[model samples]
Target: MSKIGFYIANLVKRVQNYSRFKNVFLQRLPQRFHGAARLLFYHTFTADEKKLATEIESFRSRIPALTTDKEIYSYTSPHSNTFQTDEAGNALPGEYVGSAAEAHMKTGSSTFNGILLRRIVAGAGVKKILELGTNTGFSGSYFLSVPGTELVTIEGSDALCAIAKQNMDRFSDKHRIMNMLFDEAITQLLAEAETFDCVFIDGQHEQKATLHYTQRVLPMLKPGALIVHDDIYWSEDMHQGWQHMVQDPQFSETVDLFYKGICVVGNGSGTKAHYDIGEYLPRPEIFRKNW
Candidate 1:
């Protein structure tokens, strides 16, 4: 029965992917109906989107073997309510362990998600972006692909930060990489009175930390700014955190894409709403064989 469901889902995706009329219909639908459109339609990439995707993939291919082969330095990750507990059920600090390639493959956003990020920034005319996790700069590259955009990305591991800097250097000088914990970076930005058009929360996949960091960054977001949360369904705790966020009065609308979630700061609507589109869409593979 599950396999039958999977096949049916794939067939629906294929129809949506190749149907230009359906794409146009989805694009022309009223904003209020966007949730329904997103659930039933697959976005068709524009020429610019394809160009940026190509460039990002090209840059990814040229990554030096040394960089990809190196082992990531172990570092203490932020407290995660889901997995930070010890064998005795006491809470403890969690450490990161993986190779650079492994981290990029597992943690870095995929090309499909990157295209979605690019479309969001382009569609919203986002100028300034704050990214919580810089996993070798794969996703940051996508955000920076939009012309006249500026980014400030934060990463907890010094080793990963260094790698991200190297990768980001090929793209643009408009980005700043901060090798600090998520909270530290957010606090620094807040203290500087800085504001952003979009904030991408990709680090520290914990329920408590997700809510805390999001609340801390609210004051720094410009009016109508976007808040994107990655790995929303990573765990029961993370999903609960997403649910809590969507219910908050601070956001006017929230979209749940299973792998990631997005919240809009204001929509001029007094009521809050949540959209679940993951079930209708297929999850993109984490790694591309061509790259």
Candidate 2:
């Protein structure tokens, strides 16, 4: 593209972003309340929480660089080139497993969730991590950001496995991407008596699969290990599974962060209460919930 074309493109993008902001935030609030709303949001967090929140935003800002087209093709393994493109010559994103777009579901954990996981690993002394649904290694990258942390991620799609492997190539020694079904990976790990300090479930979103994973990982957790469930309210099925998990006799504590859920495996002695930190609310509680 020429310089004029680039300029025009950036201008168009700026207009789109501004329109989006107006429609999503400004349109709902009266002009007189807009400034007060901003003040209220900023006043909701402490200094330390604000700092952590900034860090999360910083990390999120860099994610697109890692998943850019240049980066994807750079490491995309020799898998089948079956992804389809629209009439506009744009490639469509892949959906989850079993869907026609299974190879394209590159959406990773949200920035909030990534920061939450990082805090869990750092605060919980988590060294060995197990992740289900290593879609293109986006979340895997975040998990491996902690020093000395090793991630064992299970992804069923061969294309996605290869993509994740390539995406996480820098952390060669820190991650192991398995190209197999979640159940198979769990069964094999169970047979090997493998254990993990922290576990993240994000791949399959079905109630039965979520419950099944909970059952399998229960015996594999170290005492007092932390289990994080992604997309707890993604669907009625997921919500049902999360409700059952919070009620399970195994977890001593359970927290509902709206976007994700966390459970602690132990004597089941804690209050077993459910706490909700709204998605729009700053998530300082995520850092403290491990206790």
Per-prediction tally of clashes? 0, 3
Question: Residue-wise lDDT of candidate 2 within 1-291, one digit each (tens)?
Answer: 555775565455545555544455546443422332333233244355456445434433344443434233211211123334457433333343242232244356555555556655665677899998787676776678668889999876665676677656654467888877667787789999999987898855656666767887888896578788987766665677788988887886666655567787866465454444332343222221211
Q: For model 1, what is the C-alpha lDDT against the true structure?
A: 0.70
TM-score of 1: 0.77
The C-alpha stretches of model 2 lying farther than 4 A from their native spots are 1-106, 268-271, 278-291
How accurate locally, in lDDT, is each candidate?
0.70, 0.61
> Which ten contiguous residues of candidate 1 have the minimum total lDDT?
282-291
Report clash pairs, candidate 1.
none
Alpha-carbon RMSD of each model: 6.1, 14.0
lDDT of 1 by residue, 1-291 (tens): 366786677677656654543455445432643432443354456676677777777655544442644677534434335445446432332466655555454456667778777766766778999998897788888888778899999887777787677777777889999887667677788889999999998876677777877887899886578898987766666777888988888898787666568888975566776665543456433221221
Q: Using TM-score, give the best candidate's number.
A: 1
Which candidate's lDDT is highest?
1
Clashes of 1: 0
Tell me how far the alpha carbon of residue 109 in candidate 2 is from the true structure, in angstroms, after superposition: 2.4
Residue pairs clashing in model 2 are 94-104, 94-105, 95-101
